[model samples]
Target: MILFRGTGAAACRYLESDRSRADDYYLEGGTALAAFTVTDGGGEVLATSELDAEAYAGWVDWIDPLTTKSMGKPRLPGEEGTTKHGSPRFAEMVVNTPKSLSIAAALHPEVSDALDAAQGDAVAEIRRFIALHSVTRVGPRGHQEVVPVERLQTVAVVHKTSRAGDPHRHVHFQIGTRVWAAGKWRGLDTAALFKQQGAIRALGTAVLAAHPGLAQVLDRHGLTLDPVTGEVAELESFNALMSKRGAQVEKNLAAIEASWDEAHPGQEPGPVVHARMTAAAWAKGRPQKRPTTLAHEDGWRDELAEAGYDPELFLQRRLPAHAPIDVDDLKIQTIASRSLDRCAAAASTWTRHTVAEKVTRIVTEHGVRATPA
Candidate 1:
């Protein structure tokens, strides 16, 4: 990252902040600054602000002022080990060199899109891949680690490339500091290491699975995939295209989860196995299979109440001794659980109903099937 004048200076100025500000405030400022410089948000979200367009234009104006044809590409001063044609040899060298003995791939443009899309589906697809492929975890001398969902922080970068005009574009990615299990760090845990390896390999495998046309995609951009590792090759091919035009994609899992909660605010995040097991135990101990036990109704009522359904609602419905029951249908029932719902009912207000609808939408993503009958 060399500091070219003009738009780069503006961007740098935005990054430079008053050191005296509080940490939280300073962070807000930085985010605001980045937002102002990169977005066309139309005055809504900072990250989408229109200032980005202006800053970019200013940058281009500075870089190619006067719009005159030059002898060749302008040389960047003090850049060493680079070709006279101004190729970024230093970056190329770093990426080409193996990070460890294992066949390695640096985050680069050629396969960046597929790499990115792979991560999006990694959680589910990778688990499936690991189960299918007999890939085992490499112990102390391994190439990966899997942090629990709670411990992982993911970031995304988009890579691009081209040949004649655009040249290569690729994304370089770095996973910041790892989180240890149970807060422990810096010890050899081969089992844990292998588990993590399974996860990382899953990510790589999923990328190819999700986007089988990656080689073709690269070819369209004057890039090619490395057949051996199934990755994109050629730095100048992509780098020159994306030099200052690429972007870092943001992963918004937290937002998605929050939306999920809005859909099913009172629903549990884990499996329903325990609830089913308890129901099974109750079913097994019934006498004469009459199924009208006070204990059974009470248990169902209690479970429903705990989950936000009004237990009394179930009582409003008729149940009989040894009635034909669909086991799945008997598993659960719904009622508004939040205090807001209660308040709304008391005041005859409609606002809570709207909020509840929103929350229902959020929770439904977790496999809760609700149908209006």
Candidate 2:
């Protein structure tokens, strides 16, 4: 799954942090050093092809002040990336692995290499999605035009566990919002990325499933991806046990809501208030993370052991001989038909994004297994 969040120069600190510090001081992510630089909070920091000292400086306003027009004023305070207008300083894309893969990698340390290979493939696919869909929106009032300019200045950091310390492998892709287009810097239409998150997610998963390294490794480890749902069906129940983060968040939210209800009798909170309440819950529920706490093989094994789970039992659970449908035989049109039906149930109106997402749903271009960070 891919979760999109609008952030700013702050994310560079959290992702690039190689020391012992959490960048959760405030919502805007926090600031980093002025030096040109750049995670689901992935462990090791990996810069995208476009990221460099200059680009890093550009994002943080340390250098190359961004603006919509070539000769316009530089971006003001709190408007680092929005100098191009309305776009965030960064578009955060959180890429997560399927439940089964997370579980398998958690149990077997050796499976991490496969996960790494898969992550590479997944990153490639995401870049493709960005290149194909993201554009620069420009023009006068009510005469907006979208220009094709697809590329992201991203800093990807790898991580091994969820906030709850579960084997929830994921990647945090902080895409720089400003882009070079039409001979000047402009804001990439991040709304396009945000709106099409669902599509990118599905497309990413499909690509990961088809990835030879990840798929072959899973097979070697007695794990298999269920074609229909795209999860390792055998470990569904086990995977459900690793819902500590979700459980904690929900518990905190409920407690906060109840407390509010107790204090404010007969008064319902507005969306804005409710949102604040939710954020409060999230803040309260956040774990005091070390970021490298569960990095070793024994750490994860001990966790499973304490939970009374025998890792060997998982491998022995086995898989069916072959997939129900030959993956190679699946057609984009067939996938599109089913996806269209599902979309039709929700709304009648459809845009290119809607159709593209439908294709993303069933299109198995490839797959990624996130390695330990």
What are the per-residue Cα lDDT tens digits for candidate 1 across 1-373?
1222222332232222111111222133333222111111121111223223234233222221122222123234344754434321111000111111000112323444444344334332322322232122223556655433222211222222211111222222212121123343222222333333423443433244224344344444444344333343433232322222112101122233356558876443332432333234333433353222212224323433444543243334423212222224422233334534544665665443344443333232222222111
State the lDDT at 64 in candidate 1: 18
Per-residue lDDT of model 2, residues 20-139, tens digit only: 111221114333332221211121233323334334535534233223123223454356554334334566666778866777776666677777677766766676566666678778
Per-prediction TM-score to the true structure, in the order listed: 0.21, 0.65
CA lDDT, every prediction?
Answer: 0.28, 0.56
Which predicted model would earn the best lDDT?
A: 2
State each model's C-alpha RMSD to the native.
30.7, 9.5
- For candidate 1, the lDDT comes to 0.28
